[model samples]
Target: MSSHRPPPVPPRQVFTDPVHFLAFGFGSGLSPKAPGTAGTVAAIPLYLLLSGLPLWGYLLATLVVIVAGIWLCGESSRRLGVHDHPGIVWDEFAGFLVTMIAAPAGWIWVLVGFVLFRIFDVLKPWPIGWVDRRVGGGTGIVVDDLLAGVYALVVLQLLAWWWQVLMATA
Candidate 1:
């Protein structure tokens, strides 16, 4: 067993490197505890900003982020000497955006999507867990979260639809 652990990463490093800044979710990933959750929290503002665009526009932007996240995450991890380091959270940003895609418009929906995305991300059910374990490089870093987002999106849409039906009946 190698006792040599990687040196502690300086928060300033994220600012110094553009890729690290983004991969760290604009520094939100530097949180001392539960940086993944912090990264997801940082994504909320971005979701609000992008939610106003047309569906296609929103999707296009998300697609761009998702594709770029692979490189951003990979390069940052390589520089940091850690593969998918907890602080490299661009994947969480892309994943949260995926969860909020077409989500019902309201604070409640936002909260629900956030909770659902967090749950799925932390749980890493089935194929998500498989990908997380078997995949490598940036794709490995981002794909698991993407799958989690898809799971959250499905559940969120279902709950929104059911709620609408209930309101109509009421």
Candidate 2:
């Protein structure tokens, strides 16, 4: 393997390519500060649109994003001549959507999902860290975040259940 690395890509250039545009999380990844967080934040609007769909429809949409994201992210990485560049945040987009799956109908839940997803994605507990270290290419890039989303999903679901029980008692 070559140790040579490509020069940093300009933010404006992200818009020039459709794949890069998407892989950059619609430009959210271009943020100089905390691109991953920005990318996850960018996902919220899309999630709002997605949340309106039927459960099956939502799942299908999420699946499409995840599958397409692998390609989008991989291609962008190649073009950038980097591995998992910070600006490639389509993974974050897919991961956040995964966290919000079957979430309760409320902005509060959206907030919870966002926070939880961010935490796991950032912390990369357990197998999340394992995958990030060992995996390669786009699958490697996105899989870690996907696992983070799963972790968040479990916690989010449990919190929702507990909140429901508490409400019932009230």
Candidate 3:
């Protein structure tokens, strides 16, 4: 096998592949810097829409996106010939969605979740980093973000509880 590797194609080439299109988070992933953050910002509107649903409905929607993301991420990775390209950010969308599952109904909660998810994703503490390195394919692309979302979810819940306590005591 040749050890030679071709140069990366321009990020905009994703238009040629529908799976890459979604994996790029509708071009938010094309941002020159912090594509993951850009993708998370894009996810804000989607989260708002889904949050309006009943708890089970929101959860079901999250589940559907995660399932779709696996295929989209995997295919995108293959088509681009790059594993976990920084620009392939469907993972960010799914991660933010995971963070907001059954979240308290408030814009503040949404903001908190966003901040927390980004932190965990960037930091990749413990098992999050472990999965990011050891896993492969679409599962690898999306799983780390999902784990970040779970960590953010727990922190958000704790903050919500504390806020309620403060409100009651005030």
lDDT of each: 0.94, 0.94, 0.90
How far is 12's C-alpha from truth in model 2 (Å)? 2.4
Please state the error at residue 20 of candidate 3 in Å: 1.4
Give the per-residue lDDT of model 3 (tens digit) for 25-110. 98788877788999999999999989889999999999999999999999888887888888888999999999998789988898
Worst 10 residues of 2 by lDDT: 3-12
Q: Give per-residue CA lDDT, model 2, range 22-69, as digits (tens).
A: 999999988888899999999999999999999999999999999999
RMSD of 3: 3.4
Q: Supply every candidate's count of residue pairs whose N, Cα or C atoms clash at under 3 angstroms.
A: 0, 0, 0
**What is the Cα-based TM-score of model 3?**
0.92
Candidate 2 ranges beyond 4 A from true positions: 1-8
Judging by lDDT, tell me the better candidate of 1 and 3: 1
Q: What is the per-residue lDDT of model 1 for residues 1-170, given as tens digits with 9 covering 90 to 100?
A: 87654455698888898999999999998988888999999999999999999999999999999999999999999988899888888999999999999998999999999999999999999999999999999999999999999999999999999999999999
**Candidate 3 residue spans exceeding 4 A from truth:** 1-12
Q: What is the TM-score of candidate 1?
A: 0.95
